[model samples]
Target: MKKTIALLIITLMVSPVYALEALSDDALQNVEGQAGADLSLKLSINHKLENDKYVFDNGTGAVCADVQFCRLAVSVNNRFIDNNGQASSGDGYKLWLVFKGIQGTINIQKLGLDGMDLSYKDDGGADKIKAAMQLSFDATKPIEIRNFGFNALAFGQDKFLTTAGVEAGSTNASDYGYLQVTRYDTSNAPGSVYDHGRETGFMGVQMNGNLALQGKVMMFGCDASHPRC
Candidate 1:
């Protein structure tokens, strides 16, 4: 038994050697050339701004009614796909939403996963979604979020995270504070809003209405606590 175990160990150690399939001279040269080929990409999003139709609060995150649905689109390599997998070259992706202002936490009642459509210059590599995910959030005031629920890696490809980040910010009283997640749901949404407790730092993304907490309000420093505020 001891001799058999020793042989098995040796065999396992040498297995990769046989699995290495060697290529021919021309194949090897072509493979080497392809390795140095230039592969670049860019991602852009198009969205139409709308009135504050989504319900937001310092207590309950965000809630959207069916009557008010905004649109979000993503454009990459001159092509786009909707959340339902329809492809278009002129317009990329279009996601429905309800906008709000005034900072708070977010929790989706039923978050769904939408796959991605990618276009590459060279088609030598595998054709599959490299990553996919869903995200959730918690609410706070004086505006803070610290918890996240994530669902990721749907297919048998690479491990992914569903939740991305929790973001909050505000400007005027009409559009001053809001919270949001990275996924959409038509039913049974699951998420939460964090007011205060031990679960504060669990959120990866946070925006503060005040600047003393090291958080940014508007992308351009609109909610300044300094003399400019």
Candidate 2:
């Protein structure tokens, strides 16, 4: 029994020597490029949001209705290159809201700051984020969203948010908040949308288990000071 135990110990020690085989050239090539512990992406949304009628909030505090929703686009680039041609892993946000069907683009091009709340970018590698939501609804459309303004800055960044709809009494007042994990109804998620990593930080309203245009008002997120909110 003693001899058997000693032999087993010797065999265990020797096994590692045989197992130390070198990786072949093909195997090395398969993993030649090492990966950083971060993921980066850019976002540009379109066509999914467009209608034949709408309203507008023209910075001057005037609400314009009977408008046509021509285009609503927002692009965010993570690996942005500046004038110096040097690249930095940061958030660069751009937005365009065109109404009246090719009439004009709202003056929201340069959102608050170049490096503001980064929740607008890819969700990974973020330390902290703050979000401001501006919402409005048209009591007359299939999609109650007359205008939805969503903007967030991560890692000490700043941003701008605006929206359009009926008077103050109809929509929720301006409220500041922080971002949170939002689970989308993914049962009907399109394959293409999921494959490209499309995500939204906002939640929508529904009526009686259906999409309806009622006077329902709700918001997501937490108090700006709600520790890790």
**Top TM-score hit:** 1
Task: List per-prediction Cα lDDT, in the order shown.
Answer: 0.27, 0.30
- After superposition, the stretches of candidate 2 with alpha carbons farther than 4 Å from their true spots are 1-61, 64-73, 83-229
* Candidate 2: tens digits of C-alpha lDDT, residues 1-229: 9999999999898885535677543353344333222222222222122365332232233332211122233334443333444544442211222112112212121111111122332234444444323233333333222233322122211122222211122232112111111223556557535523212332222121112333423233554433445
Question: In model 2, where is the ten-residue run with the lowest total lDDT?
Answer: 173-182
RMSD of 2: 26.8
lDDT of 1 by residue, 1-229 (tens): 9999999999999887546676543343343221111122221112112383222222323222211121221213433343445654444232222232212333222222332222222244533222212221222222222221211111110011112221132333222111123333333323432322211112233232321122222212122222334
RMSD of each: 26.4, 26.8
Model 1 whole-model lDDT (C-alpha atoms): 0.27
